[model samples]
Target: MLTTAEILRKVRALEIKSKKLTTDLFTGEYHSAFKGRGMSFKEVREYSAGDDIRFIDWNVSARFGHPFSKVFEEERELTVMLLVDVSASSLFGTIIASKKDIATEIAAVIAFSAVNNHDKIGVIFYSDKIEKYIPPKKGKQHALFIVRELLSVQSGQKKTQLNTALRFFNNTTRQKSIAFILSDFIDTGYQDALRVAGNKHDIIGIKIYDKMDRTLPKLGLLRVEDAETGEQKWVDSESKLVRYEYEKDFFRITDYSNEVFRKAGCDLLHVRTDEDYVKILQRFFISRNK
Candidate 1:
């Protein structure tokens, strides 16, 4: 557990880092990647020569016996939601940073970016169930509050149920929002929930993983415990068959997550703990523009 001073220092450091990233890298990319809610009806006006014919108010035109155009203004406000996983598995890491650490940084970057763009930002922290829900609000203060919570929030449950988070997000957020799910994704049976949410909102999955997660080192026999289930097991990491099975299981889960996101028509990005997530995020934002 982090002391109050330690948490405050970390939060401050994260705020500075996230502010720089948002200002220097993500500001324009984020704006381009996500658009506003949609166009909102403003008023009816006298038709101009270059006005779009589709926007003509037929009823008003009939009453006035002349063509009048319905004017609309782009609704420029957006709500950005971060669906963060606080499962115990996220605390595991063998290189660079733990999944939870990387997630907090990424979430902070996105939160700051949303604030920079004048968008309302919110969070849904979860493990096997919803741990916390911060309703969408605008301003730098709100964004900073989210950063603090991301660094300090804890979950009583250890397992992960992606469907629970997805269902809650879909049910609570009525307006279409841009939601980013940050997790290791060590769970299953979330395809239907993801599909339903995808149909209603813009969903993106950021899978934070460590290199060790994919492959075990060639060490001798080692005992490992299941973080979520509290079960213990002994494994011969030196055995080729054991290592192969470990890697195969990792890929199986990863591949299934990929297929699920793809089938649901959602964007997913995989980032290793030691890799440059800035480049990955920049490329993703650029690709979204294209």
Candidate 2:
């Protein structure tokens, strides 16, 4: 467990980093990436060149005897939920930071970006079950509180039951939202839930992975532990067949994960532990914009 002071310190540092990313890098991209509910009428204005002809107010124009345009504002107060995986697998990382650590940073960045754009940000921390849920709200304080939870949440669960989190989100949030699922996605029985949630909300999948997960270095005998199951086994790393099987298993798991998002009509991003997440996010936003 993290102490109060430690939690506050981590929250403060994250606030600084999130603010920088929200302000400097993700200022406008986030807006374009996640759309608002709908457009609302602001006011009528005189028609100008390049204005969409579709928005011309014919009734007002007939009354005022001039071409007028209807200005509509995007109902941009969006609700963003972060469904984070706090399972044991997220604790496995051999590079710079663990999967959970990287998830915290990315979740903080997303929270800050939501608040920066005057949107409500919420979180659902889960590991086989719902560990914590922060209701959606707009404000810096709410976002900060979420960041604290993201950094300090401790769970006894060791497996990831993604369907539970998705079902909760689906039943709780009545209105449409931009939901982001951050996890290594090492689980099963979540396809129906994902499809149901994706039908009503704009869902995005962020796959967090470690480089070692894909490749195995031949160093004679090797011991591997499954974090979620708490099972350990020894394998002949030097054997060609063993290494080939490991690589094949990695590919099969990754492929299934990718297909889940694709079939759900959602965008997916793969971010390794050592890669630049900012560039990855920026490119994702740009692609959505196009």
Candidate 3:
């Protein structure tokens, strides 16, 4: 647990980092990437020479016997939901930062971007079970509160169940939203839920990983521990066969995940802990806008 002073300090640091990121990278890209619901009808206006004939208001035109056009306003407000994985696997990292830290930082950047664009942001923290849910809201204070929670919230357990989180999100949010699921994706058997959620929401998955996850270091014999299960085992990392098998497993898992995302019609972005996340995010936003 963090003391009050410690929490305050962390909050301040995250605010500075997230605010700078939002301003520098996402200001324009985020605004143009996603759109709200369909436009709403506004007051009619006199038809211009080049106005579309399909939008002509027959009632108003007939009343005055002059061409009039129906005007519509774009719905500017949007809802952005961050589905964060707080499972124990997020604690692992062989790079500059842990998976949890990367997830938290990315979540903060997206949340700040959403608020800057006058959109509501929400979060659903899960670890096999739902830990906490902060409903959709707008403003800097809300974004800061979410960052605080990301840094401090404790899960009741330390396991991964992506299906549970997706089911909960599907049940809770009735309207369509833009949702970002940030996780290491160590678990399986969530394809159906993912498909369902993707059908309703604009869903994107950000897969956080470390270099060591793909290949084992030539450290001879080493004891490995599973973060989620707390299981331990000794592995001969120096052996060629062991390293080959490890790389094969890594590729298999990644390929399966990619196929699932493709079938669900959801976008997936992979980010390593030691890499620059800002560039990854900027590319994603630009692609989304395109």
The digit string of per-residue lDDT tens for model 3 on 3-72 reads: 8789889889888998898987788888788754457788899999998899999999999999999999
For model 2 the local lDDT of residue 103 reads 90
Using TM-score, rank the candidates from best to worst. 1, 3, 2
Candidate 2: tens digits of C-alpha lDDT, residues 1-290: 78999999999999999899989998799998876556779999999999999999999999999999999998878899999999999988888999999999999999999998899999999999999989999999999989888878888999999999999999999978999999998787788899999999999989999988888888989888898898999999999899899899888888888888889997889999999998999999988888
Worst 10 residues of 3 by lDDT: 31-40
Say which candidate scores most in lDDT: 1
Q: Which regions of candidate 2 are displaced past 4 Å? A: 40-73
What is the clash count of model 1?
0
TM-score for each model = 0.96, 0.88, 0.90
Provide C-alpha RMSD values for all models, in order: 1.5, 3.6, 2.5
Worst 10 residues of 1 by lDDT: 31-40
Q: Judged by lDDT against the true structure, how good is candidate 1?
A: 0.93
**After superposition, candidate 1 runs with Cα above 4 Å error:** 48-54
Q: Please tell me which model should have the higher TM-score, number 2 or number 3.
A: 3
Report the alpha-carbon TM-score of model 2 versus the true structure.
Answer: 0.88
